[model samples]
Target: MYGIKTRLCLSVLFALTLISPAWAQTFDFGEIKSPILFQGNYKYAYRDPAVVYHEGKFHLYFTLVEKAKDKGMYWYTAQSVSEDLVHWTYPKIITPCDRNLNYSSPGNIVRKDGQWIMCLQTYPTPNKERFGNKDSRVWIMRSEDLENWSEPELLKVKGNDVVVEDMGRMIDPYLLEDADEPGKWWCYYKQNGVSMSYSYDLKNWTYAGNAHSGENVTVIRQNGEYVLLHSPRNGIGVKRSKTPQEWGEDEALLTLGQKDWPWAKRRLTAATVVDLTKEKRFGKYIMFFHGSPVNPKNPRSDAHNKASLAIAWSDDLKTWTWPGKNSQPK
Candidate 1:
């Protein structure tokens, strides 16, 4: 009994509902437990978390340190798998510490041509001096499954002998597939300020230049734009760019001592931001970072030691909420 004009209007409304994209389910920030992953006994601590969702599970790789007198300081990549980001199962070391080298800052894990690749930074062990470009370099390994890995090999540039230039030291290498330029990859690392390099093979890189000024850089693509997150001055900041080479400006996102989150009170560093747009359980951006406590005796020196892994969630990649009762951003 409907008129022709009424039927046409109803048909249009039905078409619009079918074509419009479904909005992702909102995640409750209160459900996430703080210090999602940590280490306590045996003088062991976690730092530099690198996260990737693979095979329906979240794999978290991070720098595991052991402070012992006989062994001295050792750094290796340890892994944990979680079906739901809330609970995790600790696995054996993914990348073992070399006797003569310190394997630190596990980078991105990308699957290409049915093979898995993991990149990390390395420096000679037992060196009490600060890390220099001469001693530091990025190395890579390949795996069929996520468990066993090939021997670590130095990542060399096309013409240059070093991965990064010798004048500036580099660490915390994060790999991203260059969206603007197809078939190319971008590696962003800390060299004075966030430095960049381009590669086609992922092993042979060409040093580009400094993209911006930040450390522990993690880049993600959101809504066709690239966002870079880094830790500077014991806080988390963000930079945006349409192209990977030119980051416009910096904005402080999160900071320690601003909120009463106990785990992140002293310092917040080595952040890894995971984009969960297509994820089933939680379709929001999740940031995992290392937090440390201020040494009551030597606050300045001990503040940089990252002892635990903390997490925050965001709906729009701008506003974030923590787990605790006083989770309001200051």
Candidate 2:
């Protein structure tokens, strides 16, 4: 006969074995992959990735750039779906370059009232000039399904006659549904410094103020506080805020260093954060950003060098760990 303690231990072990599989099934960590999506063709480049999880899969949208002899270079947003976040299936373009407008940067996606809304930046087509152009503006599109999108609607205030302007130009728009205030929406875009606007109905928006001195803003709420991520001249930085209008002092989160992350050689920019607090598997935060290679001959032009997407994991949104054999936060 077995001792009482030994028999009880065995019973507990058997119970865990039976429940382990079900526990794993309950929490789905879809496609946990880095550079989670990339383009193999050298003729084309992919950047500015925005992700949204709906139903049972994650839908990712990114800006695709193709250079053609006759058409010059144009950008549009493409779509991919992943169930595990590790493996993905590329689908057709979700937002395509139309005759007169080019979908340049996909900022973010959100679902409300059983409808999906995507906010992005657009530049006039054929000319394809972004600098000092008055036609550039942030537009919103709606879709019942993630695949089929309606026409782009230029967002504006009730009485405004011109397209919304950030600083002097409009680019990289990020949308956030205000957490503290119900029925309020916030749009943060790149201008002089992360500029912001507020709307009650998602249609008419009024310029609020600058949140911080960075571009490519991504904000998330944690512990009743909001954390903002932006790309400055150096690399990615983090700021905290109790409200959407005011951001706290900036802290250096991730900076480009040759030895730190070789792939992120020259600089880092355009950061997007996904919170997985509800998921039992990850239970942390994932940040995706693009890194540019150093142009040795022209260090001044390094900002416009060839770039690729990279990722980092964070527990409390403060400390981050990169991928390697022995990775630690700086």
Candidate 3:
């Protein structure tokens, strides 16, 4: 009887630890795997990854592109989970299959008021255009458990007066909390070189400002400073600022081992950083980025398909290392 009671008590404590954020530091997911997160083919391609570590598991969200015989190609916001970073569960599509509403490029996810919110964009290529039409706009969805998300709601990051149709072509929406302010939140998207908007309730937003930056912008607050990572033409670029409103010029452009890796020879972009420096298992900052293979015959195919999701890590956000490399600093 005593052994049974002790075992029950220990199980209850473990369950509580998994749900507590403060206990994340001690959680371990075992050894890391190869840098390739997801491999793409002619049938499917994965891009624009937005990842989060919750309850001792890594939940990765990205844009899943599928090729259809009758419809050509369509995109959906999909998700996959991994416990050890080596093996991942099969991806599950969470959004619709409509080409006009191709809800892809999930920037990132944030938790507010006991709910998880994810920001994304609608890339409408109804006419088989290479890029999204002018009707492209930013949006957000809310979820209670990060599994079942609400319908996509338009994010008037351009403000209430601008109107939805006049928002123009804005994509790659990333959400970040203010470094100094507690309740104030910022949404950074690609427009006039990355525009900024602030929101207090996540529903109503006020246009703040814009800056000269690249696409797929992801920001993190480190050492009392804001570190902004944006994707330039070939690789990911880094910029720094004390505040989100005012950002300095690009400091460094990082293309980690693209020259050596054949899979990333064409391009390496859409990088997202997850700072697990405090955690004992992954004591460095983890970066997940997607790359496209070189296709001389079909150059345009690299943009839509033949792209792959890969991983890399850094100790100081400057020098980097990957799975099979010799820990070369970039």
How much lDDT does each candidate structure score? 0.73, 0.69, 0.87
Instruction: Give the winner by lDDT.
Output: 3
lDDT tens digits, residue span 1-330, model 3? 459889999999999878856334443433454678789887898999999888777889999988777646788999999766777889999999887989999999999999999999999888766678898898999999889999999999877888787888999999999978999999999999989999998778999889999899999978888999999888999999999889878999999888887778888999999998877757778899998888879765637776789988888999987876765444
Worst lDDT 10-window in candidate 2: 27-36
After superposition, candidate 3 runs with Cα above 4 Å error: 1-30, 300-302, 327-330
Q: So what's the TM-score on candidate 2?
A: 0.81
Against the hidden reference, what TM-scores do the models get? Answer: 0.83, 0.81, 0.89
Please, what are the lDDT tens digits per residue for candidate 1 over residues 1-330? 999999999999888877854232344555566644674334777888888877667788888876657735677788888766667886458666663567778877887778888888875556543342256767777889887888887766332574345434567888888887876988877776887888887766787878556678888998888888888877888888788889867865666333565555677778888888677657778888887766667776544244787677788888876666365555
- Per-residue CA lDDT of model 2 for 1-330, tens digit only, reads 999999999999989878765324443333343442463233465667788876567787877666556645566788888665566786457666563566867888987678888888875556644231555677788999888899888776322554344335577888888997877888888776888888887877787877556777888898988888887876778888888889867866666333565445666678788897676756668676776665667766524324565566678777765544144345
Model 3's C-alpha root-mean-square deviation from the true structure amounts to 4.7
Count of clashing residue pairs in every prediction: 0, 7, 0
Candidate 1 overall Cα lDDT vs. reference?
0.73
Candidate 1 Cα misplacement greater than 4 A, ranges: 1-30, 39-42, 128-134, 161-168, 256-258, 303-306, 325-330
* Cα error of candidate 1 at position 55, Å: 2.6
Please give the lDDT score at residue 76 for candidate 2: 77
Worst 10 residues of 3 by lDDT: 22-31
Candidate 1 vs candidate 3: the lDDT winner is 3
> Candidate 3: deviation at residue 34, Å?
2.1
For residue 157, what is the lDDT in candidate 2? 32
Report the error of model 3 at residue 118, Å. 0.5
